[model samples]
Target: MRILLSILLVLLFVPDWSGEPRLPLLPDAAAFRVEQVVLDRRDPARTKLGGLTYLGGVELHGPGPAFGGFSAMMVEGERFTLLSDGGNIVSFVMGGDWTPRAVRFAALPAGPGRGWHKRERDSESLTRDPATGQLWVGFERANEIWRYAPGFAAAQAHSAPPAMVKWSSNGGAEAMVRLRDGRFVVLAEDRRGSVKGTVRGLAFNSDPVKAPRHGFTFSYRPSRGFKPTDMAELPDGRIAILNRRFAVSSAFTAALTLVPRAAIRPGAVVTGREIARFESPVRHDNFEALAVVREGRDTILWIASDDNQWPAQRSLLLKFRLDI
Candidate 1:
């Protein structure tokens, strides 16, 4: 009876993977610019876009299979890392000359293997702990969290929040980011029968096993029926959210910016209204990663997509100059 009840509860509120009442796309704002989407899948000597700064190029190798379907990315200054759902890691270093020509790419070790744990493992989101430089990875299907030391040399899995595991795979984490205070914030894929994924802001004390107390919560809404992919906090504390299309309109492209940091909290209620959406002229798929890079006075927003192993899809990295 308990299992049946839980399934019923999820069906009632969780955003149907099947198409349902679609949310209309909100009016477009002007805070972002999508410079280019690179479609080449080959291990390139150099992957260069038309107008953006070269972030370096990477070629990945593996014992069994190299990770494909490249998705999200995280950048700190001249250094950046890329995550592929196929479970591969790539790293790059920027050149000192400061032109697009100066950057160089280097491949890093592969992420922890799928069979390493009991869960049905697939990497979704990646975030670096600011102080420790540890990388936290969110896994789908099996619904687990793993922390890896620098260079993916060793990893330790953590028990998830009790509420999250009880909710089953539907409540598995989607994205994670470390707070200024050293606590980590996690995004739940779905909760209480709404497509709105839950944001969990938790503090990591000396112990890493348990997550206590709710930090913040936010749900996603599709403008003209789009789903949010990932989020990043700006220097001033506002959030920039990446959105992608699913189901009938799964190829739409848009984003939301200017979300005040004060608005995201536990048990706090907020909607897409606090979000200002970005309108781009290109189509996007599973725009699963985002990072903010500042060069002097200008702050650039970096966006990447998960190709889902489809030939029609492209491993795309796009750059936008923030007007705010």
Candidate 2:
């Protein structure tokens, strides 16, 4: 009887390693390491943006186990918000020096699934309505999008649009953006239909859940061997997309491309012009987050990497300027 009682106590007190751990509502920030890096080591003194400039970046570390895996981001001046693939939120304010301050961290208030596994909460893309302060997050495995109130207080609505039904479980809705004209666009990560390098793009008339059927399809041609990760809208109304590629020998590379607004219509096969590329000799990682902010006369671009919560890779955030 005593042995059974001891076993019961152990089972009750000890956490089960088989399931996903419950994350805290707000996690404390630890010491984060920031480093000034150059995009091309050969030209470390280059200060120009547009193409690629080596702005300062950071290697974020935290007390909690869920720190990296950032897949999407939104930037408003010095204020930034990041959404991790593991369904965590990391927001902070930074200055021109690229040092983060007033950092805050939290997990998504609600997820699509029962939260039993990480895939069930694989949030890969994010977008925001600046006018209303509403935010939208796209979950991959479930192929659904959830709209949240400002500050992520609550999930207002959710939808699994029919256009995303055929997308691969791990590659669904990898990039999403709300255009200034009030249209929402969602791009699949790995749904190559009839054409190679061609992914499906869905454009919604309004909020997805409210009008799920009011959407049309288009084709997006990413760079060869690369897949679209995130997207942002330029002040000029063009769309900027971040594409990524990974290989066994080359590791990872990324590119930024610009799609003209005129080409984003229904049934159109759209391919953007590559503006910048990050490859060997350039300090690049798994850069998955992209956000654009318009300053006085300059358009600032921000890109962040996902460390995959691995020891080898570092979470890097880079800033640039779009000279267009």
Candidate 3:
């Protein structure tokens, strides 16, 4: 069956979530630095990729071994926050100069975990309320959602939804976005839907962390051979979802797709239209985090990769102008 094949492929080849688990960080803050990278290693002069125009990017370097399994990220203005599946948090402020400021790192104060093991805190998806600065994180294994105060000061509330109880531990909530219409959408990583090659999705009428008892169901089908990893709300209210695929020859590749706002009604089966692809000569890694922001009249996209703490891989952060 296709589901079996997909899971087998992910277990054997995908490093985004299947790679060696990142160890827990110490009580002291971790440290890291960034180095700029090009859009295309084959040709640094290239600037276009599908609907995206490359601005710049960086490869993150941390002294500690447990530094880069980043699965979700949030961006507001020049500040960025990256969260790893193991509950590690890294924050920094960077501008056009490509220099990082106020670089700080810490672990989540609390999670669905008993503060014992990494699997207990397998956070994969994140969305936030920009107006109130509240953040919501979805944890796998436990199939729970947790809300945090601004700046991740503390955990406010959490819940375990009955709908997500049956989702696989590693595939529970992989992509999430807070829509402008006061709804939150979550996409499972590998939970198949009624339609073949589709994953289950849920729309929360309000904050799922505080009221996770109810939601409407839907489905999302990414491009062939790809699964949703992260999502963001576009400036125009559409949804930008990040899908990733792995191949032995390429290592890791990604697809950025867009789903129209009107197509997400309850029980609907939504398929994203491919807007960009990261493959072949284009520089890419296990990109798992996505964030959209607006600057002046332009909408910008920020993407980050989960290196799985592998020496051969990289913790990459990139920015682009969404020309389309």
Candidate 4:
């Protein structure tokens, strides 16, 4: 029976989702690995940082199917939580030696759709509230934001704000940050509202989902032809934004800009001052994720790149100390 054989094959290869539980699945102990790499091949110990100092970096690799595509990240001391574009979550602890330990991998307990296709789960941005430990994720295709409980145990709420409904399918919310003053800022990856080089931004007073209708509009200007990828707030209330550009020959390049707090007023267009640029002689890729941590008098910056799950590209994680 040809029909019977086809049915059997489908049952053997497809995972059962009818009774799937709400908890995340644990990955194998040896699923993830990391190898150190120098930012500059010539020196191997020094890197070009316009206003920062390079600490170290590594190339991440794994044998699992959903290992790469990390577009956003959250860091708490030595613990790191990364979210992939495929809607998978990878969390691990890295010691001073750059070795990853206690690695755990899982899928989002809930997403915008049924997780049937890659577009249905194209999560692009992430932000966390330090006071509450709550996490917020931005999905690109659906153009919505979902809030997860601490530890990502469950999805508590989600929203598809009217302002973000018109964003491009693949260019929806790409960067987000919860400011220290309890305000939330979200930046679109593409230009909107008749603006050529400017992207749309939204600021919320409280939780985005709860106060979805209570927000104001603003504009963000990235480098020409570049798009905002990620943002992190500094200890002194300024914000740093990462913008990326891709070309056929040059592959990829990135820029870091700093925005003053006073320039973030509602209904205003804000442009950040370029602080650093990544180009040739400096190892760079699709650097999309950013996070900042303060250690006494030093400001530590962490950046991660998305390999796009391609063989030719490598996942990169870099650290630098901002010199103010």
Candidate 5:
């Protein structure tokens, strides 16, 4: 009996032989290759406030309402899909020359913020289900996510937290991504409670015809000053996050970090790794959104900045090819 008890204790305390911690995930002085940094040269430029530009190639696309506001972006190979946040999810596809293909649009049914108290629609971040190529849009004001299909008219809204409804006016559902599986992970731009500016990663599943379910919840407290705007999982399962600094202070700069995937599970309290910092040349605007793409076996990280309709601030697109 004594020998059996000792063996059990050993099994309980021994480190799992199958797993090892990943360290030094990112190198210091990480060199980010500069791609074409395009300016939103459009007529009536004064009101053409452009934000969040994504580069598929020379086209250098972004979100604008008039000349192309609500023109949000998502990429698949040489083809890129840019959508309008307010309109019926009008999709403008861009191909080889970066010129947009025919426009495909869709609409959504009247629901939570639909009729009387309809919130202004501001789609912030976009992610695709790797398995199905289904599109998910996270709104900045409404604090909601909508799943859409091609050539459709209306989208199916999903269930979001009360915080989304509360912070809809500001930046609500800011950053989100779908896992290899069907579940999703999202982060709020800011909080109203003691944990204001706190980041929560949630995992849930949803269908285009139905609302999403909140399966798990985990909160991550970054270094006091940083706020994550986007997140993606590495091939090996480590989580990579993009941090944005709103204020133009000396300490404000964009950052990239890697954290163990296990550390960010729902209901689990976790922390992240400070792998790289992205600081543009003197006058670049605030970097807001990020997306990861795969070229063959190579992983590429793309970043876009939001020009708050300021002439002095030009929209910027930066790229980094990950070594590991």
Candidate 6:
């Protein structure tokens, strides 16, 4: 009986090594580690979140700084690459056993102004061509889109579209996606849409950075008070967009919405129908990265959060089974 009481006392007072929240030790460096975290600390067995089924998730940690702020993601097979707004990159492979392997820490080989400052490399959006491995990154503040060679080995080209010049420096190009049909879609983070509840978007017939003038204007209406933060092309050619909303009292909340591929065209006004919600009972954060992949017949969704290098928040990477 005495031993039992002692064990209970320790359990009550000692924090679970895995559950204790810790900030990135190094916020401005490219080194970090990944640890598995529960989907919901409040409800470990709960998995359903609207139309998504929780597959798994991880919390990335690093020395005091330079680790979080991840705003874009790419999931190819078992490899995961997360890109931060400040130009840092983290890549790793997690296999069926959920063990991370081949971990690599790197930064964009080259970017605006030599990437000397965080604002100079505020890469808020990313997209890739599966066939060529070429990548496109949208940098806010500069309102420019840069194309990189496969593996981000080199910056091939960049252009600041006149259309984007007037957008809010910190609110430009928050979401971008390359469709399977050889087109691209770019959405502004703050530019108001033609409609009250929508945001401004553009559809490019060719590479956006190469032919920024070739696309037409469009609009995307998200859930009320939410702004589209990131987007990905679904396997069926539809568009999957992530809508985020946060206030002091509400914290962070997100809505998963979809737009028909056909609705993205010249002078088109598209609406994203809400398919899922991430709030109260489920895992939620300052989610700004989103990616879609396919496994057999199941469609997969990977979402990440930008902790903004704050100790109170966390850099989260979550995987979900997209049923709808």
Question: In terms of lDDT, which candidate is strongest?
Answer: 3
The C-alpha TM-scores of every prediction are 0.66, 0.91, 0.91, 0.92, 0.65, 0.89
Stronger candidate by TM-score (1 vs 2)? 2
Cα lDDT, all candidates: 0.52, 0.84, 0.89, 0.85, 0.53, 0.86
| Cα lDDT of model 4 by residue, 1-324, tens digit | 999897787668755433334222335654677899887887787865798788898899977556888899999999999898888888889867999988888888888877756677888999998888999999998999999999899999999988899889989989998898888889998846335678998888887888887888889888776789999899999999999999998888999999987787788888878888887788878999999997778999999999988888888989999987
**Candidate 3 vs candidate 4: which has greater TM-score?**
4
Candidate order by TM-score, decreasing, is 4, 3, 2, 6, 1, 5
Rank by lDDT, highest first.
3, 6, 4, 2, 5, 1
Clashes of 4: 0
- lDDT by residue (tens digit), candidate 6, 108-160: 88777656566678999999999999999999999999999988999999998
Q: Provide the clashing-pair count of each candidate structure.
A: 11, 0, 0, 0, 10, 13
- Give residue 167's lDDT in candidate 1 (0 to 100): 40
Model 2: per-residue Cα lDDT at residue 200: 88
Query: What shift in Å separates residue 133 of candidate 5 from its native position after superposition?
Result: 3.0
For candidate 1, the 10 contiguous residues with the lowest summed lDDT are 24-33
Worst 10 residues of 2 by lDDT: 17-26
Residue-level lDDT tens digits of model 1 in 75-190: 88867577765455555554343222223333323333423331334667677766777777766665556777775667755555544564446445566665555556555544
Off by over 4 Å in 5: 1-35, 38-72, 83-119, 151-153, 162-168, 192-197, 205-213, 250-252, 280-284
Task: State the lDDT of candidate 2 residue by residue for 1-324, as single tens digits.
Answer: 999898788668755434346543335643454666666678777655446544556556655557778899999888988888888888888888767788887788887875546777899999999999999999998999999999999999998898888789989999999999999999998898446779889999998877888979999998888899999999999999999999888788898999998798888899979988887767778999999987788888889999888888878888787776
lDDT of 5 by residue, 71-138 (tens): 24455664544333343233444343544455444443433353222244566667776665566777
Worst 10 residues of 6 by lDDT: 17-26
Q: Please name the candidate that would achieve the greatest TM-score relative to the true structure.
A: 4
Q: Model 1: residues >4 Å from true position, as ranges?
A: 1-67, 94-119, 166-171, 192-224, 247-252, 272-280
Error of 1 at 132 (Å): 1.6
When superposed on Cα atoms, how far off is each prediction in RMSD?
A: 12.8, 2.8, 8.8, 3.5, 20.3, 12.2
